[model samples]
Target: MTVNPGHTFARIAIVTVSDRASGGQYEDLSGPAVEQWLRRAVAQPCEFVRRIVPDGVESVRNALLQLCDKDDIDLVLTTGGTGPAPRDLTVEATHQVLTKELPGFGELMRRVSLEQVPTAILSRQTAGVRGRSLIINLPGKPASIGICLAAVFPAVPYCLELIGARKMAEALPDSGA
Candidate 1:
């Protein structure tokens, strides 16, 4: 698939996989938190496609398919559903859509989160590539979202470049893409 990253901005899809958030019981702080962090981490502008879905393999999976397929988002970042809970199904949904798994993103986020909380192991945050879209599952906590994203954020642009999601020189300020 040819991923069309616009010259003006990179496209991103933020999905919050939580029954509570999707049910309107609570606001989706995690999804917004991810968007906030990305705005600061990425130099280029971004076109964000956001979604709040209930915790279910099908719900999350369908959201992923819609974002990665029709939207052509360069990145799909999900928060929630990565825990050990029976309802946590983000990783499973992510796996359902991924063509290639990138173990290092999950490994590094877990390692980084482990430093702050011992229960980080219970978190199953993971990442992979589907076609040209990179999908990463992250923790639901607002505090941990930034920590986990920060741990893996530096490599995100490079990862996107390597996967042909974005052109190499668009990341380089002097390259004149």
Candidate 2:
């Protein structure tokens, strides 16, 4: 894939999986939260492709695959469906379409979350690479999303670069004559 520097904007897909949210019983905070965080964190311009789906493996899997394969989304972040609940199938869905798993992301996210809440262990947040897209599953709670993103975002840019995205130069001091 050719990296379009002019298209410096990252195409981000935010998916929130919750039956209630999808049904409009409550606002989809998770998706918006991710978009807010991305807008703040990334210097590159970004466009959000958002979705709110029910907690079903097939739905999650299809959404992920479509975003990566068809939409050509650079990053797909999903919230909800990563818990121990029977409907929590995000991790499995993510694994289904991934060519390779990035285990460190889940480990690091859990570790960061564990500092804030003991029940963080119950979270099964995970990440993987499909084609050139990187998919990360996060907790449904807005706060946990922020914490996890902070813990993992440092590596995201580098990972994107390694995946053949645009190069980000390390800041250097210039001596002006």
Candidate 3:
């Protein structure tokens, strides 16, 4: 499968996992940051679905599954719950629902973040695929989202194509040239 650049808009889901944010104790900057970055980077038209959930493995897992399986979201970006803290279960929850893991996204995110903070090594941000959707876990900080998104977005369009959202017209070529 190949995604045409002219294909219809993609549906994106943004999930913010923070007990304080979910409880109204603090505003969610991370979710908006993700949305803002998507707006700037994605050339294709897109719709964003936002959610703020508590920091728990089940909550994160359920939200991700629902977005991919039920909402038919093309991409799901999560913020917060990616650190070494006790409540940081985003990586684990993501691991549970993903059909395939994309370790390079996490590696590149940390690599880019390391330029600003040594603590970047402690973050557990990750990415994976569930059905037709691609899910990426990002740190809570707005700065980190920009760094990670720049590092990994080069592959997003191609990945979306491989997942069957669009098509290419190239004739079949021999596997071994």
Best of the candidates, lDDT: 1
- C-alpha RMSD between model 1 and the true structure: 4.0
Best by TM-score: 1
Higher-TM-score candidate of 1 and 3: 1
**Once superposed on the true structure, which residue ranges of model 2 sit more than 4 Å away at CA?**
1-8, 166-177
Candidate 1: lDDT of 123? 88
lDDT of 3 by residue, 1-177 (tens): 233355366878999999999999989999999988777776546778999999999999999989888776788999999998998998999999999999999999999999989999999988988888889998999988888887787787788778765321211222110
lDDT of 1 by residue, 8-44 (tens): 4678889999898999998889988888877666666
Relative to the true structure, how large is the alpha-carbon lDDT of every model?
0.85, 0.84, 0.84
State how far residue 160 of model 2 sits from its true place (Å): 0.7
Q: What is the TM-score of each candidate against the true structure?
A: 0.91, 0.90, 0.88
